[model samples]
Target: MPFALYLLGLAVFAQGTSEFMLSGLGPEIAAEMGVSLAAAGALTSAFAVGMVVGAPLMAALSLRWSRRGALLGFLGVFLAVHVVGAVTGSFTVLLVSRAVGALANAGFLAVALATATGMVASDAKGRATSALLGGVTLACIVGVPAGAVIGQLWGWRAAFWAVALLSLPAFAGILHSVPKGAAGGPGVRGELAALRSGRLRLTLLWGALVNGATFCTFTYLAPLATEVAGLGTGGVPVVLALFGVGSFVGVAMGGRIADVRPVPLLVGGGVALCAGWVLFALAAGEPAVALVLVLVQGALSFGVGSTLISQALYAAPGAPALAGGFATAAFNVGAALGPWAGGVAIGAGLGFRSPPVVSAGLVAIALVTAGMGRRVWRERVGSVSTGAQDK
Candidate 1:
């Protein structure tokens, strides 16, 4: 793997920290800005919405630009926006800054995905992608917690400043490592044409469903740990950290083998994830069991989830940039829908355990989708081979 790939991952780590640290600083932000908690939470929603919308749009717009230019521009925007967010006193300003920062983050991620895979052999796309995405898992383990601690000690604004500061190293590294005049994409039109493929569409759906199931349980893990598993508030962080560690392990292991055995990783990981969720639901009352299951769930969720992007890239050979954007959009869609589904289940009085059940259903649907996608892929390959033989 190229050292540039790890630098890109470092950039992702900075962006991801900003993305997730908001959760812990919500109360401080609300109080400081004199807004309701719900309003503060909307800041996160704004970021998510930006990420979903910005990925493909930015990828298309930047298709003609050099890859190095696009990445540096996005990182600069991200760094500037965080600085604005840090200094802004108005909640509206902060909200807008968060959204804009997310736009930059999404664009950077899309380009980085393309750039990373381009640097590797065709067979090692999965490993390259996992190397890039490992940043997010690292953020979950280190950055978010550190941000929370910073916010607790200083203020929410300090966390924003910290993100800005973190971004500086990434910006410098990307500037030094990524070559000048690196091509962005084939063209916007070619990218759009690639999106019409049925196999690509199914691959995106698979990504969304798998990510949705993962986030569904993750979003509600805190409540389940406390109300159901009888853990204190202090234990919640421990549980989350454990999950983060497991996810890191999963991504690392998956990266090593995913390119070689994509099907087994997805199918086996999906089945194990479903079973893990079911067991988590059943064992929610047992604190020890629940904690152990969270770790297992994280491993299964990420191990499978990490492959979807590589699959998307493979399915859309003509649109590497847009494929990265599509993968980003799919994961965000899942991230949004998963929590919403879990929320609905909880609101319906299904209890905290209901989220895991909902997750199980989502995983099952994802597995079925994966199966259908596999058939589609095989058919496409067969038809192409037949045409070649006739020629």
Candidate 2:
């Protein structure tokens, strides 16, 4: 609702665009570089691995700087990396660019999320977080299409050039929107303590599993659609776009629901997510059903975005930045693992349908984990409340 929110959202849009652009450009890069598709796909995976490595590293480094400076610095790095990607003809050079870009991009998002949480009221945190992540949802729908077209029309190199150009706007937006003195205080010790706590550990584990299920299915959807669902090349992007639309809608609803009952919403969403995957496995055999199920799965999978974020923040109120960073890192770890595992399943002659079923099973695990997590968190909160009332 605030103007700062819009600028932050734009920054996220740019980041999301840059993060996902590789997926669309993978085949082009593979063909251009005379590498196999598997190797080209590794370009995308490299980014996720970078995120896992970069999130904590940059979060630690950023303790010395203001949030504004940290955000700006990362964006600058992101811009430069894209430029490098554009100019590099060597596959190794492109890999370096992607890795650097991924690292900077992860830090940028971690800081942006920490900044966003501080900008809003305690009650509006979930909604604010949702609005921020909604940019990513939009990017998946719009930015991917734009990147695909650019890669198709000019060159994949040109697509990277376009992303590089966006860093200028992202820098300008962050400088303009984020207040000069709005930086949060450092809490490296507190964050470490929180991470060591059982509650936080459980939450992260649940988040990782849930994320793995969702991303695994999504990462391979394009190939799966073509090989298993019998969808044509033209239809794959449409399905991906439809999935993005579902994500946008889910995040909006998740934001509102989280404000009322964050824990329950998370648990319910996990259940729905698992159900969506099951539906996907069954529906993949039917073109119409597959389309509908993909959209449903998208919404169900992403519906808990704000809730999961809010849960992590609440779990570690003393270390919001670290919590945010940890959540981001855990998510990417899932993203990395999901596709790799799905690829293995496909390579094993299980067929494309096997991955979605496997993903559903993972979601089912997350559902059970969410239930236990909610119970534990609720009991702890209740105990604290009782102690306060007695005192």
lDDT of 2 by residue, 191-214 (tens): 566555456666677777777888
TM-score, every prediction: 0.96, 0.91
Name the 10 consecutive residues with the lowest summed lDDT in model 1: 382-391
Which pairs of residues clash in candidate 2, taking residues 3 or more apart in a chain or in different chains? none
**Candidate 2 Cα misplacement greater than 4 A, ranges:** 31-39, 194-196, 379-391
The true-versus-predicted C-alpha distance at residue 267 of model 1, in Å, is: 0.9
Best prediction by TM-score: 1
Best-fitting candidate, scored by lDDT: 1
Model 1 lDDT per residue over 134-189, tens place: 99999999999999999999998899889889888888888888889788878998
Error of 2 at 76 (Å): 1.0
Sliding window of 10 residues with minimal summed lDDT for model 2? 382-391
lDDT of 2 at 391: 19
